[model samples]
Target: MVTTAAQIGWAESAALIFRPRVGELLTNTVLLVAITVPLCAVIGVGGAWLVERTSLAGAGAWGAVLAMPLAIPAFVNSYAWVSAVPSLAGLGSGVLLATLSYFPLVYLPVRAALARLDPALEQAAASLGRGPVRVFFGTVLPQLRLALLGGALLVGLHLLSEYGAFALIRFDTFTTAIMDQYRSTFNGSAGSMLSGVLMLLCFALLLLESRARGRARYARIGSGTAAPPRRIRLRGWQLPAQVGLLALGIAALGVPAVVIGGWLAYGGGTVWMAPDLVPTLLQTLGLALGGGLVTVIAAFPLSWLAVRHPGPFSRLLERTNYITSSMPGIVLALALVTVSLFFVPALYQTTALLLLAYALLFLPRALVPLQAGIAQAPQSLEEAAQALGRRPLRAFFGVTLRLVAPATAAALAMVFLAVAGELTATLLLSPIGVQTLATRFWSLSSEIDFAGAAPYATLLILLSAPMTYLLFRQSTVLSRADASAGPAPATSAPTTAETA
Candidate 1:
């Protein structure tokens, strides 16, 4: 069902978070990115090198540690810092908080890229008399360029839609300003105007990422040819590496860890075991799982139609999917709200509505990965399976589906993370008093009761740990067995990263 926003253009009204009067909001946003993006890129590269390429002790443990901050949501980190100092919501502190919250975007990709690189190149570079630092700068950095930009793109897109943290700290950005304008002034036009500008900014960042990442292949595909990437000698830098690693980890993870720990120590120990918490957990997880399954299922038809039909309408639909995905969660949720209440009243405030919102907000993520996976699976294999006494569905399942499952799983993980971290949609469209971990955390933190919110924050992080793992664990082996045994000879096309 197309929403009211689609019909009447509510987005323009909500988008005015970028209105000229709110020039400070635009300035704050640019300043936040200018500081945070570079900081994260540096941290990501340095942390990846320290954990994956250095002779640092317990690199495996360190690798997990570096990625663990991803489990900590930006809002939780912001909450902890503000709670600890009560004055860190200042502009500088917000930038620091945002940087720590997002560095994992760079770290996971760089780490995975480093893990997949052939050690021989660096070894050869060394043999040619280039020092390790020079070899890394020349060889490693180029290969990492796509993964790094990809990660930065994720953070940039996320920041464009960020609200809870910024809202909590009394900072205003396009996302927060739009919501405030809507709730307080009920000025849909102003909100839409701001949203329009934010949309432009999102596309701008995406375009930047696309250009930066053009046509770069990061992974070597063959199984037997793959070698563990070389480790550099961090002989004297061990102490520096350790100190830097500890400092970053402590600031990022330690604040949240200590806050949650103190909550558990105090009267809030039972908050972890609250009566409603389990049900809320089940509700949240159920929504994520069902949303993932349905989004992937839905994406196939959309992807297949484009892949097979190859027309202007198909291309338009494909791009429209991305447009929906790129919209801020709140904007999407409000769109759904207005549409459903007026048109599909039966669906209002229900699980189906919530899942539909998730699909609309995140469908493009599932679509792109599935499209790449399906493209790699090839049309020929499905045809061959059909020639061998199978139906179209069977051929797709046995041949195409099997080949595409890895990328599908990856797509699922990414959407799962997006849904789990989502705040604005849950805030608006969730049934009366529906207490998601995110909602509960926001509710408590809004009351200035950090202790009450800590458990939910911790639980939310734990719930998302698997996703954090998958972000870097893409280095794990592809599902090679299915492709190996297909009824037809499975011809492989290039992977997404391969075609870049």
Candidate 2:
């Protein structure tokens, strides 16, 4: 995209960059990220700490509630909010919707980290007379560095790449501007310039996160088992914690449910009778499943190379995937459109191209868990199988692959939910006549037909709910396993998630 944008005459590029419109978008995009990422980190870290470290009532159920926002796409959340409050718009609404929808990106990982942390450190700190708050700040928070940073990075990327959510609210960021530019003129220099700028922003975020992560190692080198972490009693604060969680749940999940239900009630059986609805649901399922499996397969080589042969080259290759993954779906779709039209016209507008786009845009989601899974699998087990007269391929499939099944399932669930809710790329690259739930919901919602859009939104959440549960289950199970195994070696290489 940067190359394509740079092809424009220098005078035009400079003029485009300096235009007032560009300045407005740059301001909006920067401010949005600056505000949203920190807010999400706070909410996510706070929520996870409450659920995982407190004696709050129904902690397990609240953990699921915290992740439920992810089952509803940000765009659908926007539709729900707009339906509830027609006047809601601009940066405040953008931050609210993005925070509600993406905080789980932080919560899930940090919750998992909290589960996996060695409680011995906290005990040691307590033995030194440290108070709870001070112990958390000094011991717990630093140990959570990798997970918190990973989640925050994901939130920032989502902020930069998101389009439909901000678009519906009339918030003009670079993504929205790029979409507008593309709609006005296909393959226009203006849109490419915006995309180039967006890519630069994404890279800057990557670099910032990288530096923040630093070279400090958090791994334990001891052979002792981790004791269960002691839960902090809320005591008089219990009521307030519950009230706060209730408020959050209402904002994140209740609003969407009420709005969609109201529309469904208003539309009656007629909404379900929409002739395209069932087919669209099936199409969405097929595409999501296919894209998720393909992304996992594509991620395998990169994960394997990074884990088995750590080097500068491997690290570079892994980071390159993140660079592409961070691009706005529209930017990626446009690039694919250009490449297909010029070099592979036969593949243009086909399911193959659409699936390819999905793999490119969401590779990082699959990479994180897969790398962690691969790193945990015992290479010695695979070698033992090879020595038992099995071929290398057979050994891997029988041993290492089996060991990483949970992680692979976690990766698949994450990507599947992402693809199922994806908007911009599906909008641009779906095969002719393909109408997945996202595209269908987007079309109806874009037309301001809230009642007509309700069923699709309902189906989107229902379809994603199971995968969300599976993702949470897998993460919890893996975290427990890691805890039981004690911390990773201090010399061990970091996974993609840690680097994020």
Candidate 3:
């Protein structure tokens, strides 16, 4: 870690920043993040408010439907758009793809927070003669600040690291540029130097995301029970609200459907087939399954330590894991590649290295939900089992682990989906001649072959749907389950991962 950080501060990093391509890359990266964050927040917060404070029928259904986009990888989403419309093919395409794929970052937390928000505060705001907007922006929004910020932080950070989708859209962001440097000039000192600069940019984003931590996280997601918020009848505007939602959902979801449909029709084959499909499919599945399992396994110790130990060291370790996960995957792939060539030469070009990179990059997505699961297990129950002569491990498994089982499935689904859709690290570090759905789509799109890319692109989105469903379901389960429980007792709230 020390050496990696130092490399970013080295003179080579200065040269990296001054290069013209580097500037364009950095600008595009910033634009992607800047554009996506607010868009995600709007979608999440709007949906949350609708479900929690409006009279929309079947709101629970809407919540699930709205979050469905999380299933579609941005690259898949981008292809659907560009392939279908061909006209929406530039900056606007990048923004749309990013927003559609990532809005759930905001949706998950804000939904949880809204479900648990205290109705009295908003009632009090309106009782004081504030308009609905005023009440929401003032009293309600302040209380939801952490959730909103945290969700936006995730969206922003994810955007910074995004690769597959942006590349397909013909955009050049930092992750794209870094991949180019590697593929075009793998051993060139210039490529490594550019990667070093990317690491710096990723580090800065990590720092900015950290600022949203204590300043935001007012309550744990999917945990705690507060009274259902009173409805804010959109008395005069109900029709408009429904119309707007329909339009938004259509725009977000429809283009991809049409594009994939047309391509499937025109090709006279399985929407799923490519001549190289089977090998790539097996490789993609193998890596996604392996990485998901590995990440979950790695997170177990950290989650246990953080939830059970309750110490500064454990806390620091957990935070470090998140920080590392927040760093762009491109940076991680580069860091691992750099390590392989210099320190672990035998591992280069091997499957083991690629899996390790996946584990490092998506570790937090695995950790957060798993930690929430562990936390939902009451500490007292574990203590009681331990006191009855059960071994600690036995007690945890016999008691807490059984309850947290659903969460494990959810975590695995999320990590697996993320790994499946990932493009940058896989592009940079996979064995030569390797192909996954991601690289398959990437190669075709790179050659401006949108028609050829369509099948892989379509499948990636279809593949993501199940994972996204599981994520929303698990998040909802955690929220509804815990909403009855309220916050962990203040004294026990700091439980470390070790104790469980």
TM for every model, in the order presented, reads: 0.82, 0.91, 0.86
Considering TM-score, which of the candidate structures 1 and 3 is the better prediction for this target? 3
Per-residue lDDT tens digits for candidate 1, residues 424-459, read 887878877666779878988999877778777878
Could you tell me how far off, in angstroms, the CA of residue 451 lies in candidate 1 after the best superposition?
2.3
- Please provide the root mean square deviation of candidate 3 (C-alpha atoms, Å): 4.2
Q: For residues 445-500, could you state the per-residue lDDT of candidate 3 as single tens digits?
A: 77877667777877788898776786688668877766666766333222211111
Residue 111 Cα positional deviation in candidate 1, in Å, after optimal superposition:
1.8
- lDDT of every model, 2 decimals: 0.75, 0.89, 0.76
Candidate order by lDDT, highest to lowest?
2, 3, 1
Model with the higher TM-score, candidate 2 or 3: 2
Model 1: lDDT of residue 419:
78
**Would you give me the overall lDDT of model 1?**
0.75
Candidate 3 off by > 4 Å: 1-13, 87-90, 212-227, 270-273, 373-406, 448-451, 481-500
**Residue 448, model 2, lDDT:** 97
Query: CA lDDT of 143 in candidate 2?
Result: 86
- In lDDT terms, which candidate is top? 2
**Weakest 10 consecutive residues of candidate 1 by summed lDDT:** 478-487
User: Which residue runs does candidate 2 get wrong by more than 4 Å?
Assistant: 307-312, 368-413, 492-500
Which scores greater on lDDT, model 1 or model 3?
A: 3
